[model samples]
Target: MIIRTRAGALATTAVLAVTGGLLTATPAAAASVCSSPKWRVQFYANTTLSGTPKATFCESALNQNYGLGDPPGVTLPKDNFSARWTLTRDFGSGGPFTFTAESQDGVRVYVDGVRKIDAWRNVTATQRRTLNLSLPAGSHTIRVDFAAWTGAANVKFTYAPRTASTVDKVRPLAPTGPSVSYDRTVNRATLLWLRNKEMDIAGYRVYRRPATSTAWSRVSGTGLVTSDTYANLPPATGETYLYEVRAVDKAGNESTGSADRSVVSVDRTRPASPTGLTGADARGGVTLRWTAVPDAARYTVFRQKRPVNGEIQPVVEAATVTSPTWTDTTAPERADYTYSVSAVDAAGNASVRSADLTVTRGDHPPAPPTGVTTADSRYGVHLQWSGSTSDDVAGYRLYRDGELAVDRIDRAVDDTTRPYTFAYEDRNARYGTTYEYVVAAVDRSGNETRAAAVTHTTPGDRVPPAVVTGLTATPREDGVLLEWEPNQEPDLKRYDVYKATWLGDGPIGSEDGAWAIGQIAWLNETDTSYLHKATPEGETVLYAVVATDDWGNSRAPHTGQEFAWVTVTELGTPTEG
Candidate 1:
């Protein structure tokens, strides 16, 4: 509840004096004066009633009587005397009111800056005249003028509400503090205003007009007697509307309209969901289709990648189209992708997602293997080559001597390094056998690339190479450096160094299959030294070496030559000096 101080009115009265001589007359007897609120009264000694007055004071009422006589300190003429009264007061509530002016000569009256009565003339006897009025609840000013041109000089005035009769002559007060509110979901607008306090208030009338038009149309019913609030008024979405209100009394009198307020209605309802969503795989793309939705301004496309590792989840908006069909030209072949569509209304409301459609791109072959090479042994051959770098490459296919030896070689076969390459050991060949090896990469779509072929010939039977000896490990600034005596075999192809966490149970060290041949390539078998950099810290390291002859026979366990080892205890990550 809000309270406000009622503004008070400023009351002021002025009396002007004129150059008129006083009139002589015998003292006259007094008559009864009307009873009413006090009024500022002044008497002038001339008919024109101009200039300073002979008598001025606050009169208890407008009624007064003097008969051809003079009062004790007064010297005003009785025949041509004039009088005026002014009153300023608050009416509290606006309603129909009446005013009566009785005078022996002529009289005039004014209310709230408006002249309501005028009968200024000469007359023989006191004649009474009445005025019907409707006054709004606020401060008002009333003024009366009278002239006594004859014997007995007298005047009186009175007023009251004319609500029960046909005296109403004024309109009700205008309502204040008008406001408007709209609900987007319901498309309804409500109007409210300050209540009218007029005693004879019958009801209020509500009106509205488009913001762009000046013609107002009534919104409320005939007589809204109980509520100052009008609700459930339909307003077009996206359009501006203005509202105003006016007060009316039981006598059908109406005040001016209140100030107009405006609001723009919004559309918040979502469009219907897209239906019949379908998709098909096209050349290098995916084509999607769906049924058109009523009132849908556009359609939005969303995509979700395959649920495999690293895929974006829940999908996201991809594109907006006015039509019901869309093509995803950027979809990659042989990859899993799912699509969905949604309809959007003019107000930016999007419908729920349509059913999902999954697609796998068309087939595309893997790239060819590069750098193919082979090493021959007394029995079979060994192959090493670079693997395919394509994301869809599933494995390799190996062909030997113009025949397929491995149809599907899983990429995991070479798990020794990141981005593993292809390596194989062919142990099915007889001595002196000539062979041609070819390798090709296959994709997940079953497409294979052109093979890269290499030729090799197995060596004739010969004695195995001598064992490598005198192996030693010495600590260096970078890491442990290993040294060993060269093998006695004149056809030694290379030397391979092996390391492990020396469990110390067998000639090859502890046998948990922790054996791995270091990647270092020793082209010269006579070069019997190797440096191991950045070895794992806080562990005993074991080192061993095997000598390989041109026939691919390693002089260790392969040829019954027990491997000799050198051990370094507590090796730390090497540091630069």
Candidate 2:
């Protein structure tokens, strides 16, 4: 809503004056004039009398008869010359909208940068009109000049996009898809088909078929009427059935039939308990979550204002989704929405509505919660989420290997760290031994979700040692100079060198029930090379570095000691580091 100040009118005569008689030669491509519009009082002389008999509106509301010959005894209406235009076609967008008005004398239609009718002229009021206007989708501007021609005149113009839907084409009208419902009283079934885009869309048809048979029977009345509900459906009194629908246009154009909507027409009485119900304002959208029923084809989600009557609840937003979730961005702000959901069977019958849920949206995000999953023999089990974004999360907390570990924080996980990752070498368990794990996300709020459980077997942890660089074991004066190029991880926290007599023998960290042993002694500092104390007496001390990087991610064990060629001389008690 804006007010436009009237400048004046630019008649076709001005084009001749500016370009020196260039009547048809590209009138200097003036800017569109819809950008600026003017309003004025007008007179619609119904009765063809003499002087101004009555005025619908005038230049000014008070100046009823300033120029016309109307006296003070006559009352006049306010200036009624106003109109909002819609574009039929536009040259470009954004306007230097320039238009021209052609009136003999006493009238003018203001356009951009042009003025014609200075004073009244007695000449015939005839002028070829042209308007250059910037055309936007919705509202626009129009120009008209109908001054006192024989006592009165009529004001009229035409435009497009009379309604909001005419401009926004993405609006969805009726629900589409196979729908089924069941009835209880007669043990019958009812099918519903909806095909609607605009209020002008016609109606729908319902096709019925039994679960055991392949043939279908089309109900009466080619769906050309006003209603879509099909009555007296399959009277099997609790039989599963299938149904489908097609839409017909006003001109008798019938669209292809929709996919079948399957149903079971359960007890046809009360609906089964609705499950997986949850609510949240997620990722800038309102989401209602639910678990899907195994045999149901569609979940009927209903929304309405606070209940008003005693029997039926007012339904506002009724929509369906492929899965169990329904989203509504149209929910009003600061207002509560009551929702009820029902499962519709393949037999064209719907269960009674579930109890309503009142949901509200808040401004803040819910705190991060803890959860976990497991992958057999894989350190990383994968992480999933259910809560809101964190405002001050430094990183996350990973729990594994019988202990809690930190993976990432205010810092994001590098190519190295991951979620659901265990930080310990519990690989010693027998192949079928079950291992436990969990993960938790820590936010600036220090709040966390309950830890989730993950159970998996170690599958003998037999994956070959993953060495990044080369691996080699050389015999040296210090029993065995068991050295290896350390993993190049700056997050290298520490390294535990393992020594086993045989390549396939038990690892040095095997406990009572575990074959992996922790006896190999060269615990080298994370930053230095190592010469394991006096080579233990055998072809075994197969050295491998379990490098723990700085961020607490341990490099998978890599073997360096090729014990097949090296032999160690017995040392003092063969002490372990």
Candidate 3:
């Protein structure tokens, strides 16, 4: 319980008063107020006395006690008690006494028969007064009023000297904030708190004990500081600690102990290594499974990317519940990968990592597509392929302008997409401009192979078949002239020209493909030229060719040179188409 007084001071315990008294008490010794009653007083030379009174009283001297008495029955006055003292205790020097009569009971202290302490009641209640005698420091007669009673009679009293020892005062501060907390890294408990408002503080003392124990002893203190921190405390290993702090002020005053707190510190040691790690299929990715260690809080999985030559640095993708299984969701296909696992305790301490488990699966890359690459638009492009993704391919790929344009499975499927296409819509591309293009193939194993291409660009985002090279058509007197520069391709295979009355500038692959006028087959890899004859005069002629590599790479149809325009002496102006 807390005790509070009207003075606003509070404490845990209250001071009790002694009750009852003993009879027939003997007066053992007597003493004086000043040093041996050598009434230290001062007297002025020419101060005359007033009021006519008998000289038997000690007066007109330095009077110390002038009033100590009961009130008259005539009036109910306030508590007015004083001792007139013109006396000074100057460790050594003495001087004159200028005095007056101020008393309580009938006057008993007087000088020259003049009463100083006035009291009309009998049995004085400890009346005291002093006067100046102008005497030396040796000794002097100072009288006291002995009336002890004011109303009902009791025992009389007198004045005596009592030695008083100085009082002790205290001002101490208490520690604040969370006194204790767990240290996750070291698996230990750390205690921290602050001290403030310590006035005249000499030092602080800390005392602590186990919750189950009652004995508390001093632990430590830095004498003075606003705060303190302690860590790595295995004090009593697994038990809780209760602490209190006391402050000692400079004047030997001690403040009572502050509030106490019981703190529990955990031991949080790490768990055992995980076991039985196995891999299984989780959808398209591999699922890694492991046994959870007892007392383990979480598990972490790592992925190791197989390097070209050096050792691989394992990477931890995530940590999860100790169920100990993780789906390798980011697994890469057709490549070697390694893995490892570890167990983490509640304190975040991790166990030694498990042994490395590795697997080598696949190493194949996609086969190169046998196709002709050409730029066909400001961003439009074309590719013609003649190969499959496998000797037994699930699909074949055709790319235009270096982007995948076709993915078809089966040779029969390849035959249907004879012409592959791509159209770029980049805002930064220009119309009627030149660009380069290439094509690569991706296999069933997610592997990509390099390009098989022909370099040819069009007047407007189109590339002609280079294997066809050049061509011309003219109507002569005897017949029509049809000529073509054989494909410069070292693997030139064949050529074919189509003839009809064409409507647009599009090449042979476009709509309205006309009839074939002639076809030529190449016999040598060094063949750089070819020519064909037209079946009729004034006919529109379009030609295209194919170049086949040892690996079956091919080219697409493209516009040959425009040579069908008529030139004649009869017509001075040449007819242009």
Best-performing candidate as measured by lDDT: 1
Which rank order by TM-score, best down to worst?
A: 1, 3, 2
The lDDT of model 2 is 0.45
By lDDT rank, best first, the candidates go: 1, 2, 3
Per-residue lDDT of 46 in model 3: 12
Q: Write the per-residue lDDT of candidate 3 for residues 536-566, one digit (tens) a residue.
A: 3444444444444433444433333432322
lDDT tens readout by residue for model 1, 203-319: 889888888899988878665645788875555446688888888776778788899888787766577899898888754257889999988899999998887677566677778
What is the alpha-carbon lDDT of model 3 when measured against the actual structure? Answer: 0.44
Q: Tens-digit lDDT track for model 2 on 1-577?
A: 1111222222231232312221111122331222222233223322222243232222111112222222122222222221112222221112223344433224333323233323233334344343444334233333344443432212222222212332322222223654566656655556555445332244655567778889877764544446666664563435567776665433333455567766664434333646757777642346888766665667788887554454455686478655678776555434467777787766545656677787874333224443334444354333343322334333456565556654543333222433222222333345546656555555444545435666665443333322434445666546666555656543344665565453344554454223233446535445445566663454444455565443444334333322222234334444569
| Per-prediction TM-score | 0.35, 0.21, 0.24
Quote model 3's TM-score.
0.24
The model with the greater TM-score, 1 or 2, is 1
In angstroms, give how far residue 302 of model 3 lies from its true place: 1.0
Where does the lowest 10-residue lDDT sum fall in candidate 3? Answer: 69-78
Alpha carbon lDDT at 108, candidate 1: 90
Model 3 root mean square deviation, Cα atoms? 22.1
* Deviating ranges (above 4 Å) for candidate 3: 1-232, 235-261, 264-271, 281-283, 294-297, 310-322, 345-348, 362-577
